[model samples]
Target: MASLAVSLGLRAADPLTNLVGIPNYAPAYLAFHFVWAYGILSSRTLKQWYKLDHQESPRYDLVKYGEAAVKSGKITKRQLNMMQRCESASANSVENYTFFLGAIGFATFSGVDRQTVNYWGLMYTAARIAYGAAYVLIEDRKVALVRGLLWWAGNAACFALLWAAGGKLNA
Candidate 1:
């Protein structure tokens, strides 16, 4: 393993590489967005889960279910609003996935160092998670500025990754 890291010009102690003990970390980092979105949308403790617990699989058409429930008076509009916010956060994650995947994928394939890739991956993930959580939990427009900041922070990581990848590719 140490030999493998040495061969790749990567340190054994780099965070994601250390976590997965692999030369490439892009795929793992990319897949985490799916994991995060799934956890947020369908996790056991989420209100949407309990509200839609009657279904065999609530995730297939969560928006439809939530809308129907609200229309039929089974759930309140406020409840629907929260569910939509959660869904929007998950959708935002999915929406951002392609760009992130491209940036990180290019970085790893272009020979960007493992430590740099892992650091940006960690930053992107943390900022995105905080952004999503804040989006779901905060209703105030004033406080919601935090979510916007986090979104920019995550985007900064992606731009940083692209810059690093471009440098490596150019060299």
Candidate 2:
């Protein structure tokens, strides 16, 4: 949405509709979707890693519950450290995602059509949720890579759109 507003000046009725041209909408939509995908991947990865570590130690099948696992001789400090790292990664992803959302909102408010901006925002939210579910439920490397590609492509599209729009608006 922010990308759209920045690329094409905001109009009154449709936030999703490009004030400058129809093509401009594609880039904004793609950027929004990609950000969403990244969020999904982050969430899915966190859930899987959490579930895997929550139970018996990765080293052994022995059941040592919660903090006891660390207190007893079962799990090492390193394993706990790894779990903390996963949490940190999730937190970082969330921060970045919010930044992207803010960027979209800023762009939208600047000049983009309200309907087009809103539409892209909705698409992005939905895609992110699906992406997260897919990431958590599906662990195949190929699937993960493909999903990641979708996000990259979306971001690339946004950048390209912005660049094209800039020539007209910024000038």
Candidate 3:
């Protein structure tokens, strides 16, 4: 009985699932995180490849590529700066997802209701995807609003997971 409760992410007295189940949501979120990061990093690579139109450049650094393009008058200085900003933001977004994955893992193993934890995990991932796209693709005044909303939503879901776990505590 105790083993089944822990496996189902329930406190011993909280009446968790009697059937078998593992902490699968953690891996699912991790898988999506990897795919998300891969898409962002790959897109950046493709952008660099397209800049030279399939011709291989000795330098793979995006800012260096931008600098060469700027010097050659192929792009403006401000454009080069924005390119670096987008790449930085994409990398930072991936790092943020890694932190979220840690929190999700803890929540899953700490005996929170799996369904509730999974729901919030899904929310956080979806909002993160929206936030990353808004940050990288949108460059208008409205970008802040769109990204801010998603950030708040994701944060809310993170807190909700903790709250859900707290509610299940035996105390």
lDDT of 1 at 111: 76
User: Which candidate's TM-score is highest?
Assistant: 1
How would you encode candidate 3's per-residue C-alpha lDDT over 95-157 as one tens digit per residue? Answer: 777667767766776777777777888899888888877766666776568788887888788
* Model 1 lDDT tens row, 17-136: 344354565678877887886664433335544466435665644555767777888778776666667877887887887878888988887878887898999899989989888988
- Candidate 2 C-alpha error for residue 46, in Å: 9.4
Q: Each prediction's Cα lDDT score?
A: 0.76, 0.46, 0.67
Q: What TM value does model 3 have?
A: 0.69
**Candidate 2, residues 63-116: lDDT per residue as tens digits?**
334346567755565555444433443454455465445545455535555444
lDDT of 1: 0.76
lDDT of 3: 0.67
Q: What is the lDDT for 67 in model 1? A: 72
Looking at model 1, which ten-residue stretch has the lowest summed lDDT?
Answer: 14-23
Order the candidates by TM-score, highest first — what do you get? 1, 3, 2
Count steric clashes of candidate 2: 18
| Candidate number of the best lDDT | 1
In model 2, which runs have C-alpha deviations exceeding 4 angstroms? 1-89, 153-171
